[model samples]
Target chain A: MQRYFVNADPSAEITLPSEAAHHLLKVMRAGIGTKVELVLADHCVYLATVSVTEPAAKLKIIQKLLSNSELPVSVTLACGIPKTKEKPELIVQKSTELGADKIVFFEAARSISHWQGSKQKRKIERLQKIAESAAEQSHRNKIPLVEYCKSLDALISDYPATKRVVAWEESAKQGETSALAHQFNGLQAGDSMLAVFGPEGGLTETEITKMNNAGIEAVGLGPRILRTETAPLYFMAAISYAMELS
Target chain B: MQRYFVNADPSAEITLPSEAAHHLLKVMRAGIGTKVELVLADHCVYLATVSVTEPAAKLKIIQKLLSNSELPVSVTLACGIPKTKEKPELIVQKSTELGADKIVFFEAARSISHWQGSKQKRKIERLQKIAESAAEQSHRNKIPLVEYCKSLDALISDYPATKRVVAWEESAKQGETSALAHQFNGLQAGDSMLAVFGPEGGLTETEITKMNNAGIEAVGLGPRILRTETAPLYFMAAISYAMELS
Candidate 1:
């Protein structure tokens, strides 16, 4: 069954937006009485059937399904904006599947690509679409938000969490293995965690120092040196394994 | 400093292979005394310096670095061949970075792309190069081998491990969360683990039943529905977290 995120009252008819309407009617070739899952304004999954498909795509709700796929603790991934276009897209897509609540890209000292002005808005919009699609394909209850942070300092200040950690290769080099597990173990239900990651060249020493000063602990993903795009995905998977599977 | 996998005696002068020589001498513009880490036939990392770059790139071992980046448990990821060209490449690159010992792609019942005859050899060779490069970039002690299997039966029967588990979405739906953790915890040092994952459309019930009859246990990665490419990377990271970090 297809899943769409729509904001509408469950008591009323749900009309998909233009893009989603095109997708359902044209791309998927869904006709009237075609059953699909809709995530309503309350972010709950409901079984719905296509009722009107000519002028606009509309569906009628059957009943609320007792389904919740969100992680128990919300996870926010703050990554340094990578140089290539593909890295951010990969990060948003994979992290959303791994149960990230929000994905933020910040301009670090070593960042080569800067999304500024209108470009920033366009980039975030595109990545947000990718997140929504991935969330639906992964059967997630909610779509992860994609945002942009101007700098590392702003990221640290704007996103306050119950626990915060910066992934540092130096920490792994120093064999500090317990910090990430320690942080995961300390979390309670509904607690939020903000994990910061570096870009291609990785976060500079000054950036690490600044994060260290802000009371954010430096933790290692593991011993192997993961690339900029791979680290946050690793963190997201580790978190899921810790909180969900284990 | 760069890292390369070389097969030579640590007590003698080491000659770089043709590709590594070109990468070090031309691409990286390495000069005399340019230090690099080399993994010898013994699979141990040694600090080496460029002693001669005339006929062939040659280096002298300075000392052993006492570095070990391999996982305590060797992981073999056997995946159903995906349709897109990029999925296999992504799986090879990212899984190597996360410390996979070997990666196998087998033709599942629902596999869209089939690598038959000579195409299979060429594809494996290309993917092998990607694994080697990713291994070097991630500072891994060993490059994960890329292999192709004719069928799922060959994958299950040939590559024997101390433990075997298939990633099944139905297992997750049935609330089988403890199986994966139980398998991970049961693994001891130097034990090998074989994890099987389906392709895009997923494995058929017959395939799952065959594996079940072969005594391979079904395990869930997590609650979310991960794509074929994303599941192996998740397993790699989760294993690293369970065995290496925590």
Candidate 2:
């Protein structure tokens, strides 16, 4: 069954958006009486039957499905803006599928790409589309938000979690093995975490010092090196395994 | 430092291949005394210095780096061939970076894309290139091999591991919380695991039955529904966290 994320409350009757309506009626060829999953603003999954498909897609509530596949602990990934455009797109799409609550692209000392005034909104819009589609495909309860930060300073000051850490290369180089797992082990349900990653070149000493001052601990992913985009996905998976699967 | 994979003996000093030489000298623009890391056929990282950079790049070994980033347990990922061409390439590239030893593409019952005679070989070659590049970029000791199986039957009969498991949706649907982490926890050093995943449409009931009969355990990744490519990366990261980092 096709799924759509709507901004209306679950109890309210709402028409599907234009893009979603086209997808349901034309792309999916959903007909009258076709059942689909709808995620309303309340983040509840409801089964709705298609009432009308001619003018625009309309649905009537059938029954609520008892389905919840979200992570117990919400994860907000704070990544340094990478050198290329494709990296951020890939990060948002894949991370949304892996159950991220939010993704913020912050400019680091080594960051080569910068999102200026108008370009920032357009970039976030494009990435948010990717996140929305990925959320639908993955059957997520909430669509992850994609935003940009002008600098690491702004990102560190804005986002605060129960636990905060950076994926530091020096940590791995110095053989800091249990820090990541230890932090993850202490997380409880409803707790959120913010993980910081570097760009293509990697995080500098000054950046590490700043994070240290902000009370963000440095954690190593593993012995092997991971690319800028790969590190966040690694963190997502590790967090899921530790908090949800373990 | 630049890294390259050479299929030469560990003790022997081998000349860099033409392609690798061009990449080192022309693309990277390395100096005559530039130091680089090379992975030999023995899967050992060796520190080598450029002896000559005139026409072709030449390097002489100095000493072994004594750095090993491989997972304690050998991993063989048996993934169903995904629909798009880019997905398999992405899986191979990312999994190689995450330290997968081998990657096999099998034809699942729900697979949309089929690899024919010449197409299979071409796909394997293309994915092999991706794995090689990713291995070098991630500073891996070995390049993960990319291969294909004709059917699920062939995949089951061919590869045997100390422990065999399938990433089943039912396990995730039932919310089997401890299955994946327990499986990882039970693994010992040098133990090899073969993990199977479904295609886009997912594995059928009959296929699951067949694997269960073959002593392959079915385990869920997490609560959320992961895409065909995302699931395997999650498995890789979890394994790294459990065996490498923890």
Candidate 3:
């Protein structure tokens, strides 16, 4: 069944939103009596069936499902805005599927591209849409929010979590393998984590020192050198494996 | 320093391949005495210096560096060919960075597109180049091979391994969380693993039965519904985390 995020409270009938209605009626070609899944504002999945069509599309709620696909620990991925537009899109789409609570793009000391003024807003909005579509496609209960920060200072001050770490290539080069596993060991259910990644050229030593001063430990993903965009996805998958599977 | 994979054995003087020579001498603008890392055919990293660049660029091997980025267990990813060209390319590139040893594309019952005749040869060759480039970019010692198989039966018969698992959505829907973990627990160092992933529409019942009969186990990556391209990547990252980190 197709899934869509809805904002309204649970009721006997739901008048589908204009965009979702068009997608269901036209794109998916769903007719009256077609079944679909709606994730309400409460982050709960509800089964619904189309009951009315002509003037407006309406769905009758069948029942609420016992599904819970969200990760146990909330994860926020803060990345330095990469050089190319496609990198952020790939990061948002893949990380959403891997179960992220939020994604933040901040300009770092080594950042080459600046997301300024209206471009920042448009980029975040576009990435937010990508997250929403990916969440629906992955059957996620929550859609992750996409945000931007002007500087690493803003990202560090704004998105504090129970545990914080940065994906540092230097750590990998130094053969520091267990720091990430150690961080995962300390996480509890409902705890939040913030993982920061560098841009293409990588984080500067001064930036690393600042983050270290702020109590953000540096950890390596593994031995291989993952690209800036690949690092966050690897982190997400590793998190899922640690918390969900094992 | 930039890294390149070479096909020659370690010698006092080694001539760089035309492509690697072009990248070093032209693209990178390297003069004599420029230092770079080279991975020889023995899957070892050697620090080398540019010696001559007139007729053919040659490097003088300085010393061997103690570095290994390969997974403890060899992994072979056999995927049902997806519809889009970008998917196979993404899988090849990302999985190479994630430490896959080999990648095979096979036609499944629900596959919308087919790879036949000269097109198949060209597609596999292009994907192979992608894997090689990704390996170099990730600073890996070995480049993963990309090949194509005709069917699931050929995939099973041709690629035997110490353990095998298929990423099945039904297993995920049924809340089979620990199967993948159990499989990872059984893998030993130097052991080989083969993981199969379905295409967009997923594997048919008949294909699943054939694999089951062949002693391949079905395992769920996690609770989330990952796309065809995303599933192999999740598998790769999970394996890396299991063997390398925790």
Candidate 4:
């Protein structure tokens, strides 16, 4: 059954948002008695059926299903804003499928394109939509949030987690293989992690120093040099494998 | 320094391939004395400097660099050919960066598109170019090959490995978590792994049964539905984490 995220409390009947209702009614051709999964305000999946569709799409909740498809430790991926438009979109879509809790694009020292004023809001809205669709497709119970950070300092200050690490290319170059796994080992259930990544030219030395001072350990993904966009997805998969699968 | 894969043997002087020469000379504006890393026939990274730019670009080998960016265990991704043209391209490029040794596209029962005759050759050629470029970008010593398997049976027969597994969604739905880690644990260094994935509609029950009978274990990536392209990349990153980083 197709899944849609709604913000209503657990009740006998709930009305879906306009976008989701349109998707269910026209796009998916869902009619009366059509079954679907609704992730309501509590971030829980509920079995639902189309009860009414004339005024608006109202779903009648049958029973709450025991579905939890999130990572044990919440992962917030703070990436340095990449040069191209497609890189952020790719990062958001793929990382959502890989089970990211939050995706934040921060302006780095070498960032070419800057999202300012109206552009920032518009970009976030578009990326948020991508995340919602990806989460539904991946059967995730919760949709990951997409946001923007002003700078490295602001990102670090705002999103403090139990564990903070940076995916530094120099760390991989130096063959520091154990740092990432060590961070993974240190985490317990319900702990959140903040992983930082750089843009095309990579993080500057000053930025690295600042992050290091802020207690963010620099770690490497592997020996190969992953592009600005590929590193975060690699981090997400590795964490899932370590914490969830292993 | 830019890296290029060449078919030449390690020597004092070697001529660059036409494509590499054009990229080095025109695109990058590299001239005499420009440094480049060349992965020659021996699959070793050699530090070379441009010796001539006339007629055809030539480079003089300085010394072999001690660089090995591949995973300890070889990974061969056998994917059921995806529908759109971009998915295969994305898979090849990203998987190459993540350290895949070889990538094969096979025709699955549920596969929508079929690569036939001249079209097959052309598609493989285009994807191979993508792999080569991605390898260079990722600083991989070996360029992963892109090939087409006529069918799943052909893929199984041609590529025999120490371990063979398939990324099955039903396995995840059934809550089979440890199967993938178990497979990874059984692998030793220098061992080769063949991981198969389904296309959009996913592998049919009959196809899964055949693989099971052939002793290919079905492993779940996680409790999520990965798209045709995302599944292989997840498998690649997981293997890299288990075998290389961890």
How far out, in Å, is residue A109 in model 4? 0.2
lDDT of 3 by residue, A1-246 (tens): 899988878864588888888899999999999999999988999999999977888888999999999999999999999999999999999999999999999998988999999999999999999999999999999999999989989988999999999999999889888999999999999999999999999999999999999999999999999999999999999999999999
**What value does the lDDT take at residue B125 in candidate 2?**
92
Candidate 2 regions exceeding 4 Å error are none
lDDT value, residue B8 of candidate 4 = 87
Clashing pairs in 1: none
For each prediction in turn, the share of the native Cα contacts (below 8 Å between chains A and B) that it retains comes to 0.89, 0.89, 0.84, 0.81
Which residue pairs clash in candidate 4?
A: none
How well does candidate 1 score on lDDT at residue B103?
96
Deviation from native of the Cα of residue B144 in model 1, angstroms: 0.9
TM-scores for the candidates: 0.99, 0.98, 0.99, 0.99
Q: Which candidate should be chosen as best, given DockQ against the real structure?
A: 1
Compute the lDDT of residue A221 as modeled in candidate 3: 91
Q: Which is the leading candidate under lDDT? A: 3
Report the CAPRI category for model 4. high
> How far is B174's C-alpha from truth in model 1 (Å)?
1.7
Q: Score the docking of each candidate (DockQ).
A: 0.91, 0.86, 0.90, 0.89
Better of 3 and 4 by lDDT: 3
lDDT digits (tens) for residues B16-113 of candidate 4: 98999999999999989999999999999999999999999999999989999989888999999899999999999999999999999999999999
lDDT tens digits by residue: candidate 3, B14-60: 89889989999999999999999999989999999999999999999
